[model samples]
Target chain A: MKVILVGFGVIGKGVVKVIDKKKNHLKSKYGLDLKIVAICDRSGAAIDENGLDLKTALKVKEETGKISNYPEKGKNMSIVDVIKTVDADAIVEATPTNIETGEPAKTHMIEAFKNGKHVITANKGPLALYFNELTSYAEKYNKIFRYEASVGGAMPIINLAKETLAGNEITEIKGILNGTTNYILTKMEKEKLDFDTVLKEAQELGIAETNPHQDISGLDTAAKIVILANSIMNKNVSIKDVKLEGITRITPEALTMANKSGYTIKLIGEVSENKLEVGPKLIPIDDPMNVKGSLNVAMLNTDLAKEVVVVGRGAGDIETSSAILSDIISVYLRTKNE
Target chain B: MKNNKKQKYNNFNKTLYYYGENMITLDLELKDIPGELIRALTPISNMGVNIFSVIHLREKKTDGRVPVRVVISDAGNRLNEVINKLEEMDIIITKVNETTRKTDIDIVVVGHVVDTDVRDTIDRLNKYGLVVDLDLSMPDPFKESSARMKVIIETDKLDDLCKELDKISEEKNLLFIKSF
Candidate 1:
């Protein structure tokens, strides 16, 4: 699969590193001859008519903060132009999520679909807001749309629900969906500290963003719920459909009280036929959904087999990019089948 | 099998697998009454679905019920029949997790749900082929209970789910509030 990766931020770099590490393995094991035709960042896009030397491109990106310094770079073309003109089989949209507008990434995905290119996105905005439209576009153009990294990072919740548990009907999906809030909650629970104190530590550790409204206010989890509801359980719902609550109101006293009651307070996103909500809830201490630290866990409730829970890191560069790579392989195999 | 050192560097873990062609996990909420959990799992065992693992949260209590998570794989093609039997037994088969290309709609059913027998209403809705998943909150067995449910049905069947909700409201004398 010849690819063009847009948004050369942390996830983009992570994708480059994972592809480089798994280059030979993918070809040998999966029969996927993966190649990168172009790479783009916020500032500019870099193109190589043939495959680009990603290692050298990574070195340049690390040193100069731009891939335009690559040996065969075009003069900073727009991402749209690169997506339109690049002779590639897939586009990896790794841009930061913008739920408000679904922005440049949404337009980029639309452009990719218009050009009959498969898409793998880490951005949640487009999927949360316009899942039906984008999915329909992919079908109309006969392109594969995969966004494993959008929810659960390396946990593979999307793929697990989509592929592993294939026949049983999914009734509900409950998850410790966001790592930042979970981190804050864990710290508050273990250290008996308040939300602000733990949040400051999280910000310093680079787990929570400087402007941490989305992560703290439960919007990020809401976005993930929307994507999961639409992609897996097949609901045409959006963030607005979720009854949102954050951990900001949770106090150390409350945590201590919950502990006394044999429960742990964690932000849980519950998705079912009649309910979509993300808020701090009291999960039993031994419950699988009560995973600690930055780990993410999703418990899928089904009719036939019962309940299955998957747990893994919900963030980090390599972890999330691993999801993008899986989506890439899915597209590769699907394309081969076609 | 690869060595641990080599596996450590391999970032991608292959999870896109179907234990066979059909694997599912059920999230069930059984009435705290004795034998309810047994009643739920008996048909599953009888149908010969490969039991992967079962996690029964006996200590966790919600809505005066015990939440159990059962993982099973069906290669013999009898999983649906097992579910149908469970439903007929009024075992409160709370959630059926399977893979489908259907939209999931979540809503909240508030007030006196358990008194109206939510299981019967769900079974009635199932008659229309609208798959339903419930997370109920009936903290006190003697009082009113609300539920959060995810309805997995085709896009065209959304109206059907809504109409069913309306019917459930009228018949059960409850308020159905769709989560925004």
Candidate 2:
């Protein structure tokens, strides 16, 4: 599998590690030649055309915290330059989520499809923002666009909604789609931590970003729900349409009192009855609604059945990277040229 | 005639409540033992509270416990009554949370060693401070036939429920399933 990775952040780095780890098994067993030919960060880009040295690149990342100073073996280029010019099977679009306009990643996804390249991404903003248009473009260009990691971290929710429940009409979809918010809420309830306390702890735990409004304010979940709604319904939806809520308003006293009251706090995103809203609400102690810590996400009220809830580790380097690999493998299978 | 009208109005002394309002559904968990579900629910039902829907599916865990999902009418201050009833019943509840419909939250109080004393968990939720809103029954036969229930209460009480559930679960050999 030949590929190019964009934005070598934590998740992107994880993907590279997995590919490196499995390269031997894939080659010896399946005759697969996994190659990450190019890597690009905002500062600079490196292209080996053959393949970048994964070991040196990783060491460089560990040392400098960036994918620079690796002796620049390949043709050094810009991210846009690499995306436009690279000859790879797919683009791993793991850029920083630009929620405002969904710019570069969105544009880059289009470019990849137009240029006959498939896409596998963990960027939620672009998918949530342009699900309809992009899916249409994929169809137009005969490309594959897959984003399982965008929501539920590593949970196979996208597949659950699209493939498993394809037979059902899927009248409703709901879950605690954000790990950061759920972690904060859990800390607040368990350690008696407040939102800010839990939130800061989340940052220390590497579960949240420095400016985590997207995760804390429920915007991340809103984007995820919008993506699910659009994917299931196959329509173009806007974030504005989904009701939004954040954990910032919650207090320690409230969580403590909620304990006194027998309720758990979770930031939820729901879409059903032709409407979607996102916010924190009190869930019962045993409804499978109050999944705690970083493990969460559930789907209820499907078309063919009553309620089916799926749970697992919602976030992890391995899990998220595996999702991206799934996207890549899917693209490889679809365009295998066999 | 005017004196008669004034007297009639005074005699009525009735409180008016508006209808057609959306009710938030809350999910709750308690002991699956005997008399627990009724103890958790009767207090609220007698207070004129309406239930929207109840989903009771025994978790199918070998531990012999139950899980219930429920919806209720979210009218006026009915939340307070529901919370009081669950606390009274020692049942732990989370706000009945849904999306694209209404803003609600989901909570749970998991039980372990449920095979022996099914009602022990729910009984604890009914005691004090912890709020509850709904109660349900599991459908499976030959499994003590525990009830599945959903309840809604305030968000602030979540930690207290976890602490209490942890404490109870520790002593009772209960499987404190965390809320999703």
Candidate 3:
């Protein structure tokens, strides 16, 4: 399979590293030989019709901070240009998310489909804002679109519901979708620290971003839930449809009070038949939903299966790349016979 | 005639009502004094009802009252009599079987809990549910204070109570973190 990586940030670099690491395994286990035809970043794109060397790609990206600096295969070409002209079977759209507009990534995906290429993206922006539009394009061009990494990174949720638990009628989906907020809340409850104190400590420890508005303000979780609502639950919803509440107001005293009643506070994002909301909810201390630390957990309420809970690391370079790689292989297996 | 009546009562006691019989679960709030639990259970015992399991929620005690779940065999169609007897003894029956007569909800309010007319806040919430337990923590008067309250309300009125909390939140600039 020939693939084009659309972004060269942490996740993009991680994808290159993973594909290199699993080259032999992918070939031996599934008889699948994967190749990266191009890697795009803000600096430009590096193209190789005969498959770019994975090691040199990572080295150039690390040393020069750009894939366009690759020895002779690199060029100053836009992402759209690469999508339109590159001879590749699929495009792995791992661009940075723009929740407000879903731009750039949105354009990249639409162009990928229009140019007769399949898309396997981990971008949440376009999915949250333009799911129907983007999906319509994919169907119009008859390309397979897979995005298991968008929701719970490395935690099989979208595919788990749509594939493994396909026959069950899923009634509700709820869990802690964001890891940064979970870390802050878990630390606060454990040490009885205020939100500001704990958040600063998390930022220093790199668990939280310097500007942690989206994760802390529930926007990130809202975006992910919107994707699940649209794709898994078959609900036509967007980011604005979520009734959001952040954890800024939570105090140590509040956690103590909740503990008094055998409960703990978590920023739970819940989507059901009559509800779509994200806020601080009281989870029973011993419940499965009460996973500590930066781990993410989700519970799917289905008619036949009753209830299914999934827990995993919601973020990381290689962790997220693991999910992206699965999608790549899935696209391969499904289209291999064709 | 008195001997016959005594013999019938004795027979009712001897008949063991085990599984598959009509079982009634009573959710009661009892005073934390000695023999309070027995005082709440003695009425049904005298009515010839077989007792099953008593789950005492000791950790959920608030305001000197412990919540206990008492399951008993409702033999002889005496559910109403058991309820009346317990109520007559001043035992607060919060729920019976699957029907919730009343339920306890906890809310942690953050803000100037005392300055923003906390009395009116509680009074407004009291319209939908009774504020049974309140624990206030005021780190500094100039800063925001936190208050934890336990409200016992009818299950049907939970939505109304939440709406009222939202209204109070908007009106007084307070954040009500509720346990749903």
- TM-score list, all predictions: 0.67, 0.65, 0.90
Best by lDDT: 3
TM-score of 3: 0.90
For every prediction, compared with the true complex, DockQ reads 0.03, 0.05, 0.42
Candidate maximizing DockQ: 3
Q: Which is the leading candidate under TM-score?
A: 3
lDDT head-to-head 2 vs 3, winner: 3
Expressed as tens digits, the lDDT of each residue in A198-241 for candidate 3 is 99999999999999999999999999999999999999999999
Ranking of all predicted structures according to TM-score, beginning with the best and ending with the worst: 3, 1, 2
C-alpha lDDT of candidate 2 relative to the true structure: 0.70
Comparing candidate 1 with candidate 2, which one achieves the higher lDDT? Answer: 1
Q: What is the Cα-based lDDT of residue A320 in candidate 1? A: 95
Q: What is residue A1's positional error in candidate 2, in angstroms? A: 2.3
TM-score of chain A of each: 0.98, 0.92, 0.99
Two-chain complex of model 1, DockQ on C-alpha atoms against the true structure? 0.03
